[model samples]
Target: MASPQQYLNNPNVRKLLDVIASAEGVRHGYNTIFGNERFSNLSAHPNVRKSFRQTDGKTNFTTAAGRYQFLKGTWDGLSRQYNLKDFSPQSQDIGAIGLIMQKGALGDVLKGNYQAAIQKLGGTWASLPSSPYAQPKRSQAEINKLLGGSAQQGGYQPQYLSAKDEVRLFGKSQPQTIRQKYLSAEDEAKLFPQQQPPATRYLSAEDEVRLFQQSNQNTQQSSYLTPEQEAKLFPGG
Candidate 1:
């Protein structure tokens, strides 16, 4: 049977985790809480929920912590799946790998297929350059630089690359047209009407009473005892 620490044992996974921690902004501080605070718990996930102001002055609430900044609910499910014992460094790596495997990006990640891996994980962690979120992001070139690529190839900025530039950097691609994406809720509802459960049937008060009486009479009729049985039960009754 595979142990819970399987991902932590693999050298490739260890290296990948190091890179990912840097991307998530927790390389030096594993217990780095959301909004740049520090946590001191390792026994379990530090599910300290908080609302902090963003650079834009908007408030954002989070329970995100540790290297990958796992949300409480997200960690709960991943921990169960990966059998993570605690929020230790090893456990975090294993749990992070479990998430990568869940997204079908583990194979790509191990193969050093950066673009493919980042694309797969875009919607998951909002830190990657491929992510569509409006958060602070590490550019494609910047992350590649972490992977030991030249500064000329991987730019210095912490921003995304243009489509043309990305094509120039990484050869092949699969661009998603607007039509290929899923429809919005209202449009989807128009196309496929919401399915409702069948209505429940209920008997009237009069019908319920009649059914109870009929059932009681049937029970009595079915419970008929022989003369010998009646004599044994009630001698003179």
Candidate 2:
């Protein structure tokens, strides 16, 4: 079945995540907090409240932490919605995928439609192209490079699910009861969060289309809160 962690194994998805990390300046530090705020726990969201100056030249108190630079409100909403268990690297990746799904970018992302995906995602990540925030953001060319480049031969390949996998997920005959689209703690546990996940072969675009349709049928469409909403919810976020 199409699960959160499965998306992380996708070449395009992984590259997109790398783009986010690079843009957020967390390429080497998934544990790093926003604006040099400090923390130690991986068991849960490190709700580290501190004021930090952004490039905008004004200090905003924030809980923006981890590889994706999630603010507390954003993280909370994602965690609860996706059943993300902690602030661990695995959980963070899953949470990021959750954000992608939330922003309606997963279909475009699966198809390596970078511009469209980035457009949908920009609001949630200010450092991405098309962001509403006035912060410094990456150019399309820069994002292309991070995604292994569009013209680079044999650099990245699209992922597709096998026929058997497709049948199991969508059913061969009568439609099986639609299952939960998000992962459970038990499901997440099967992933072995401590270890680096193996390279993932992914679902076909057709399968992805169906999976996306199935997911929309099952999950609530909760948009990421706006910058103003975040600031109000988290005070300095």
Candidate 3:
């Protein structure tokens, strides 16, 4: 099983993570399977029904599990293909990439084909800006922000190409190592500063309950557990 640390060093994985981070943020530990408070069970959510191990007896609905919010059926197929051990943040990251590759969108992502990539991935992540399903949709600009493209400006910056190709296009190309082309610490820091990016936090069960209770009333209540459901989740108050 590849550890999160091991996956971290892989530039390809890091870049893919940037895409997920931009789309999902860290809400509900969207990109992590551990290292948070409340919702302690990374593999399951109290109000959610289905999990990789079992389904919640209350509602027969299948929960999208893990950081990438993969449904149990999806994870089952990916786990065997990738030999994943657990749904640790790293494992989940790997699983997501596998799905992207399966859809043939990895190259589009690396090449900064934001629209095409989003369209390809929309089938898997319903929240994608390109998805037809009605839900919170990420704008192409948000996705392009992480992709280092100019889509926000109505064009896309070409991804790092071969030095010869770069010279052919622009008459000059900065010397870059293969790894340097893929690694983007600056971009990661820009999107999610190390000091503290918005919404990534640890909360005690009480704090979590209170936080949700005080959340914006306008938000769709059905999207999250109701206070009554939460009370049932953490009983004996």
Candidate 4:
């Protein structure tokens, strides 16, 4: 694994990972990029810096704090190996870089292999919603824009069950029952303030995708919210 200094030595890799971090929602000092305010509000405080052992013989703590959303599980394996301190923003940033380096995406990232880098990093970042890995993938265009690079065309395969595949499986792609879906609590709170946000918890991309598939039969279905709904949800820009 590359040392934090070595990782830092390559500014482009750092920048790319920073873009991923931003995509992962690490915009604040004490919260994930999403609005998870109040660090001390959980069994394991969201802003917890040190790793702690829970009563169930498992460790519980904020591994996802800092600017990079470093999970405690990942940090547990990496902390001593890298001589990391606590879960400060700097520590989180370094840990994120370390994760990318460990995933073997560092070199590809430095070489401007956006899609390759995204593919490599996808193992760790679930937010890359469009990855073939079936995890939640963010927009490649948006990620590329953040990296100051042009979008890498193709190579991404959506993991959801497509309409054709659904038809093959169920004879008819559409589910017999289509219920009206409300905005996800996480999304509703962030996009629409009228509704109260639920307690914050880490929802993996797989969980999100599975829920998405359960909701709509069309694997390639578009936005959950229509333009009118979106306009109401996000009145501003």
Scored by lDDT, the top model is: 2
Per-residue CA lDDT of model 3 for 1-237, tens digit only, reads 432344445565566666765575446665333222135554532334532221223323445655666767788888888788776667777788888778877766556555676778888886577777544568877776766763324467546546654454445554554434332555445434655445423445666566578776775544354567557555643
TM-score, cand. 4: 0.49
Winner on lDDT between 1 and 3 is: 1
Q: Clash number for model 4?
A: 10
Q: Which portions of model 2 miss their true places by more than 4 Å?
A: 36-38, 54-57, 151-237
lDDT of 1 by residue, 1-237 (tens): 444355566666666666677888873467788877887788899899988665467878879899888889999998888777799977777778777787888777667665677688877787788888656788887788776662132346444445654444444565554223334555444444545333323444554564455564444332344565456444754
Worst 10 residues of 3 by lDDT: 51-60
Which candidate leads the pack in TM-score?
2
TM-score of each: 0.57, 0.58, 0.48, 0.49
RMSD of each: 23.6, 29.0, 29.3, 25.9
Residue by residue across 19-105, what tens digits does model 4's lDDT show?
776777655543452334336322232534555454346754444555556666777666777777665555666777788788887
lDDT of 3 at 154: 41
The candidates, ranked best first by lDDT, are: 2, 1, 4, 3
Candidate 4: the clashing residue pairs are: 25-33, 26-33, 63-70, 63-72, 128-137, 128-138, 129-136, 129-137, 129-138, 130-137
Worst 10 residues of 2 by lDDT: 198-207
**What's model 2's overall lDDT?**
0.73
Q: lDDT of all the models against the reference?
A: 0.69, 0.73, 0.59, 0.60
lDDT (10s digit) by residue, model 2, range 158-227: 4444555455554688456554454445544544455545433344455455435656467663344455
TM-score, candidate number 3: 0.48
Give me the runs in candidate 4 sitting further than 4 Å from their true place.
29-35, 38-63, 130-136, 151-237
Worst 10 residues of 1 by lDDT: 194-203
